[model samples]
Target: MYRLLIVDDEDIITDGLYEVFNRYQPERLDVCKAYSAKEALDWMSRTRIDIVLTDIAMPGMSGLELSEEIQKYWPRCRVVFLTGHSEFEYAYRAIQMTN
Candidate 1:
């Protein structure tokens, strides 16, 4: 099974994604939710995360920074960023990080 960690400052987004993944792919995915980058890091320290779905414009640590931290510890882990903002710079930076 793949371990998926969904991080978002908004409880609704985090909880919604958690429920959606659990409902749709319970057998294939072990989904976890985090309300902040700090909480996500806490989860990472405890267990191996295969994938992370996070919001980019968080209060403390941005998703881009979190991604860099994740890459340092879990080089193979995949990160997917989600944001309500429609800024071109955010998208550009996200793409740049993937390269």
Candidate 2:
């Protein structure tokens, strides 16, 4: 099974995503959620995750920073970031980093 970790500042947002993921049954991925970067890091250190879905603009450590750290530590894990910004710059950077 694919392990998935979700990071978002808002509990409701993560909860909604969890429900959606469950309803969609996205490849039977195991889902876990963290409301803060520190909490996410804690889980990451202890657990093995295949994918991470996170908000780009989060408190303390942003998703970009988290992804970079994950790249250095858990290189095989894939990161999918979400942002409220509709601008091209954020999307461009996200694509660039993921690619």
Candidate 3:
């Protein structure tokens, strides 16, 4: 089973993704949710996360920063960023960092 952590400041996004993943792939994935980058780090400290789906423009630590932190500890972990922002700069920055 893969451990997936979904992080978003918005309760709805986290809850909705949690529901969808659980409903669709309960046997394949163990899904967890965090409302902030801090909470996601807390989860990471306790458990081994295989993948993280996070919002980019969070209040405290942006998803990009969180990704860097994750890479330090879990170098093989995969990060998928989610953002409502349509700005080209956000996409460009994310792509640059991943490369």
Candidate 4:
């Protein structure tokens, strides 16, 4: 089963994605939701998260900071940004860092 973590301030976005991922993914994906970056980090310390789907604009910490922190704590955990921002610049930078 693929353990998934989704972080977004918007409840609807995270909730919708959780349903979609659970319905479509071939693996028995276990999904976790965090309303903010802080909550996501807290959950990470406790559970084994395989992937993180996050919104770039968060209350306390932006997705970029959370991604960096995840790299430091769990290098193997993959990050997929889900942002409303039209600019791809942030995504490019994040992708480069991930690689």
Candidate 5:
């Protein structure tokens, strides 16, 4: 099963994502939700997360920082960012850094 962690500061977005994933749970995927980067990190430290879907403009630690940390610890983990059009440059830089 593919384990997915969805991180966003907004509860509604996380809840909506969980609901959507739960509705169409193909490939036996498991979804977990976190409201902030800190929360996501805490959960990840104890669990084996296959994929991290995070927002770029979070309050404390940005998704870029989280993605870097995840790569350092879990090199094989996939990190996907959710960003606004204004944050395209940041996302581009992050993608470039990873490559």
Candidate 6:
């Protein structure tokens, strides 16, 4: 099964994504949610995550930093950043991090 982690500081966003993923019933897809980067890190340490969908700007650690962490610890996992137009610079930085 493909494990997906949705990380967003806002409860609504995470909950909404979770519901959408669950409703779609993607082939062997398992969805998890985390409210912060730290929480997501903790979850990743315990679970095998295939994909990480996170917001760019968060409370403590940014999504870019979280992606870097995933690269180091869970190198096989893929990361997708969610950001607003105002955070385009952060999103650009996130894209650069993979390179």
Please list the Cα RMSD from the true structure of every candidate, rounded to 1 decimal place: 0.6, 1.8, 0.8, 1.7, 1.4, 1.2
The digit string of per-residue lDDT tens for model 6 on 30-93 reads 8999999999999999989999999988989989889989999889999998976585678679
Better of 4 and 6 by lDDT: 6
Q: What do the candidate models score in CA lDDT, each in turn?
A: 0.94, 0.87, 0.93, 0.89, 0.88, 0.91
Q: Candidate 3, residues 13-50: lDDT per residue as tens digits?
A: 99999999878778899999999999999999999999
Of candidate 4, the 10-residue stretch with the lowest lDDT total is 18-27
Q: Point out where model 3 deviates above 4 Å.
A: none
Q: State which candidate, 2 or 3, has the greater TM-score.
A: 3
- Tens digits of per-residue lDDT for model 1, 41-93: 99999999999999999999999999999989889899999998979899899
Best by TM-score: 1
- TM-scores for all candidates: the values are 0.97, 0.88, 0.96, 0.88, 0.91, 0.93
The candidate maximizing lDDT is: 1
| Cα TM-score of candidate 1 | 0.97
Task: Show pairs that collide, candidate 4.
Answer: none
Q: Summarize candidate 4's per-residue lDDT along 1-99 as a digit string, tens digits.
A: 889998999989989987888777646888888999999999999999999999987888999999999999999999988888878897787778877
Candidate numbers, best lDDT first, in rank order: 1, 3, 6, 4, 5, 2
Q: What are the runs in model 1 whose C-alpha is more than 4 Å off?
A: none
Q: Pairs clashing in candidate 5?
A: none
Better of 3 and 5 by lDDT: 3
The residue ranges of model 4 lying beyond 4 angstroms of the native Cα positions read 25-27
Candidate 2, position 43, lDDT: 93
Error of 3 at 71 (Å): 1.1
lDDT of model 5 at residue 17?
A: 88
Q: What's the alpha carbon RMSD for model 1? A: 0.6
The TM-score measured for candidate 6 stands at 0.93
